[model samples]
Target chain A: MNWKTVLRLVSVDVKSGRLIRGQRLRRYRERRLFQYLLYGGACVLGIVIGLGAGTLYTAVPDPDLRTLFYEGARLLFLSFPIMVLIYSLIFTMMSQIQRMGVRSSIQLPYWLPITWEEHTLASTLAHLIGVPLASIILFGSAIATVSIYLEAVPLAILTIFALVASAFLASTTTEIFRVLQARLIGAVYKSSGRAAVWVRFLGSLLFLIAFYVAWFALTSGGGSIALIEMVASAQQAGWFVPYVWLGMALASFMNGLLAQTIIFSLASLLFILVLFYVAVKLNAKFGLYEPPAITVSRGAYVPKVGFLGRLGFSSLEAAVIRKDFKAFTRRRELMYVFIMPLVFILMPLMQYSGIYGTPVTPGSSRFLSAWILLAPGAIMAVMLGTIIIGEEGGSVWLFFSSPITARSLVKCKYAFVIIFSCIVTLVCGAIGILIARPSPDIAVVLLIESMLLIFALGAVSLGTGIKGADFTEVPRPRMVRPLTVLVYGLLCLVLALAIFSPLLLHAVAMEYIPLPVSLPKLDLYVAISISAVIALVVTFVFYKIALKNAEEFLIKAEI
Target chain B: MILGLIKPDSGSVNVVCTKAEDDPVAVKRQVGYVPESPRLYDFLTGLEYLDFVGDIYGLDASEKKARIEEYLEAMELEGREGDMISSYSQGMKQKITLISAFLHKPKLLLLDEPLSSLDPRSARIVKDLLRKLTAQGITTIMSTHVLEIAQAMCDRIAIMYEGRLLALGNMKELRQKARLPGSDLEDIFLKLTGTEDVREVVEALLK
Candidate 1:
């Protein structure tokens, strides 16, 4: 090995590490390493538990382990699309870092008499090294467990082939998204026409919808077929259905059917290799263009409608809000905040209506109502709070050093939360009407439930806003594990219940409860009123604590 | 008629203002500013960027723009900004940070770098901008540096680092307290401070 080449590679890793470490140290201080390890451990634990549960549930007499192996392989195949989405998010974040200058370290070798191709290759290797190792480990565990369960050489070989194909698929998908984003932005800048920009934006939205629809059909239809086969043949088609031909070819080879195995393997390899090559070439060509410079010329001084002005905010608070709004709207990534909430609203409707054809019943309606009211709060709590601090980037000192009090900054953030929450609540109410078409009494229940849900979400969001660390520079990986997701979901559920319990009690008293005993509607009203009063008190108390804690947090922050 | 950031709607003012109508963006092509506080994106590298000033001045294309290497070399920033500006030393960032105000060879320069993080070498380079630009009839309005350096470098210096002007004039004319003759600029500065005992104390501290 050439020592100089090796040292150059080491320097690249050191520079990337130093850049990441400095960011983590400043934003998270000593807690970052612990948090990363905690998240990784959670993921591993979840996988182990899930695998154990699957094993316990197996009921086949003289159960062929091949069935379990096939099931595990299927789960891995299903995880591919999610992995692709995560890879896209990572690539977008990495591009942002490169734009900022973290990638500039690669230029050092350029000045040091190193060839461009070698430097690029080394940099690519270093880049991959920086990506979290969690996914690879997970993939490895999945393959190992599946292989052991089946003790079938064919299934094991096919699983390996699928894993490699998935990686190529993920990389290609990310590149496609990047290219589309770049082209769309370039067109917008070149035209300087709002209509053109809107058209492009809508086109991308439609494309995503079509892609998801196609994906849903394939996965669900394939899953149903596998389920039928499991019932009929006492064989789990798990990963086998997705990699059916590969499995067949592998089985044939194991049974001394070499001609079939060779044909299948060669075709699959050729297809994946061609795609990988094309994606690499496209990425190289697209990455060369510089980001467009947007120039905003000052126009006539138009005193716009002061929304915050009506909220009794000081001039400083209004100014900060305006600044944040301008910054948020300018960046395409931040626009996800507006779009994502609508997605949450649509998810239940899509899953139920698309596959099962089960129209929303009264029971499902209650669940939907709860989701509508609380989903925005949970999203804003994590996504908004985390991003608000992170997006300030290194210019956080501007807020700190300004005459604007920290209280005002925090208040403005809360104001945004409230405004967004109200919008979400209104949308939820509308959806409830469409889904339930309930009596006037039901409408009132929804109104009260929505209010309680908003307050509860507010309290939780305030807590997260104060406690969450900035992860602005940390490229978002698939960091949150299933357990963490489950925990968050359970927390939201508990908050929603606490908020809506009064309404539930009111329904029971009004003889709206199906079982036990009939009671007066007035008694139900009284119960709901008391619950509302308690929720209000709790919200106020949390708001005060949030303000105090947030101030302390900001002061202690490393900005 | 172009909008100006500092324009007063109903007040009379005599300060020269660059309006967008007069190609305000173009005016910034030649202007450089050292803001009261430097704020840069933490993720961007030093040499990988030409700074926001460069972009605002519209040097987006190749050939016309200053090479990142040239600025790094001139600012003596070698390996610093190549990492994120967030990782830079305060003084290092301040030195190499050429605002859009100066990116286009502005005929006028505005600087707030007086007694903060600027080192001697960086300080000297900033001082040279005024001399070089003014030779081409470019005007400079700098918040004063150390009184001695200001005295030596300025043709018409205004001492206003404290947010209010203390004195404004040429060095020779403002040197009334240098009675012993051939007293350097530092002695003139001491005289301007106006108490013999306090001056002696300050002089002793400086020595």
Candidate 2:
């Protein structure tokens, strides 16, 4: 087995993939200022953390400080492996989910006269996926060192060792998952429509729950049972578990138990070797599993049960919208983006639950809840809107070929974003209203505000996306130019303030801000009427402007 | 320019009773284009892509199903319909692209390097399919660098040099015009387009 060749090949492939191309160079240049600012900010923050750590360790005579950092470093070191595993598995799953385009014709690996046992799978798991993940997690490890700087100076190399070990375990775990996926994906796909997706979703959920439970159990020291006792029991129960060996090694080293440390350390190493062997064996198994043939007529289209797909749109627009929705749902990387809006929706409920511990009566809090819902909904709508055409990857020509007017296309994209955002908002609002028990008045107000902003935000973002989109690029920018972003931000801000002018005017009347002129505040009835008019006006103006701008850009694009 | 992906600087394109500038939707509805390297959504399976195309063309549910089934079998893409296009071989991808283009039953079918990656058998099938489609009075335009294929298939061949059509005619007409009746399309193309004699160039390349 030519292990060296496998290692070299994996390294070269991963390194080359990271190399920016001519197309990306332009984008990098465009983001140069922002990149510099971010890097600069990180450096400054690191310096600050370093100085703060030194100050606390040396000057702070408090006993709690000593115990706090000691415990903090202990937890960080122990949970570091779990964090690495979660992140690595999540990313590998995402990449697998996002796999698109023809298989790259780089058949160099196949040409190598070596079997999977030649450390090919190991190198791929460790280098292609593992090395990049380790490199990313390295940044977090460095930041973590700052919090435990007092001890990092003494056990610096050992801490680095543990962090590196985390990366290896992460890759090994991810390789295990990959083998299972490769074997089961075909069967899952054939079982029922979206069976693979459902299985993957459930798998991800279980993993996340396990991760959260482990973290919570490890961190929580309160209640009738202590974390130490629970962990002791688990450790005893899991004597054969591999990861426990690392922890035992660390604990024994801390306690100066040389014999125990050596035993646990050797056990950890032994398990890692076993894991690699299993990974190679599984890769071979994965290679051998051929998917049963799918009859073309029966397998052509699997119509999704999503709400958006059910809304029959213009055939062309519907297809485009459906594709966007499908891409969003199928791509695991997009799971975060989809979940973010829902979390925002639930924020008010969480706050309410915290405050009253029961359903709250209709009051000022209902308006606050409504604002929370709209705020995230607006952001979600805009972010979703901006990607409509840009996220088409290499399929931009589909739009260009359609002969559908740019205005019509943009409008459809805007509508899709609006529809999706509304669905999220409505789900959140219903839950919030159920828990918070807002009055009919507040509910009506929430509905009206959501509808107005959804349309306005959607149009503005779709316009911005179309105007700045470079059709030639693949995996197009998720964001607009920084300068354009500022413009869009200002437009969104103005519309938002106009929508909330009644509240703002009332606040000003109540002397929240000292205005140059003491303008008399109108009644709620009058204020609401005026704001609704302004919202309507803003929505109409933005929609028209966005549509017209999109038309011009589409017509002028050189393709 | 014809598909509105780009704007024309000095000319106009009109096809299928629709002007390119007038209404892109109408023009697109009547034109099925297969670019030299069509950038398909690789994330989609063969069937999904065809279905999407069917929807884009506004095909009725039953009609789309029948057409998709008929072509999938004809193109020999039956068994692998459920696989992601990313997993498809080049020849397989090309077959799927061809199937997608025909789903809409457009009036004008434009093909660029359509047979670039097809197997010999698949190539023959595509040629037959193109012939059948064109015989239905659908205007077919194909662009390829392979002179033999151009000569063998096209009723009227246009030899382009640096974007200019140096000569345009049927096989007999072009041969007569080029004063190379015994030569194939390559010689006639070279003579009319004023390309230098290639005997020495070919020998040098071999060496």
User: lDDT of all predictions, in order shown?
Assistant: 0.52, 0.65
What's the C-alpha lDDT at position B110 in model 1? 64
Top DockQ model? 2
Q: Find the candidate with the highest lDDT and give its number.
A: 2
> Which ten residues in a row are the worst by lDDT in model 2 chain B?
B1-10
Least well predicted 10-residue stretch by lDDT in candidate 1 chain A:
A473-482
Per-residue lDDT of model 1, residues B1-207, tens digit only: 111223345654222464432333334334555556666543344433353334324343342234544555677876444344444667876765553245556555666654368788776776676678778887776654455666666788654433455556776665543453666666665555544477678899999
lDDT per residue for candidate 1 within A405-457, as digits (tens), equals: 44665687766666666776677667756764556666676666566656655
Model 1: CAPRI class: incorrect
For candidate 2, give the lDDT of residue A428.
Answer: 70
| lDDT tens per residue, model 2, B1-207 | 776556678788887767777776788889888878777776567887887788778787788889988888887877788765655878888888888888888898888988999988889988998899889898889999998899888999988899888888899999999998788998898889887568888999999
For every prediction, compared with the true complex, DockQ reads 0.06, 0.38
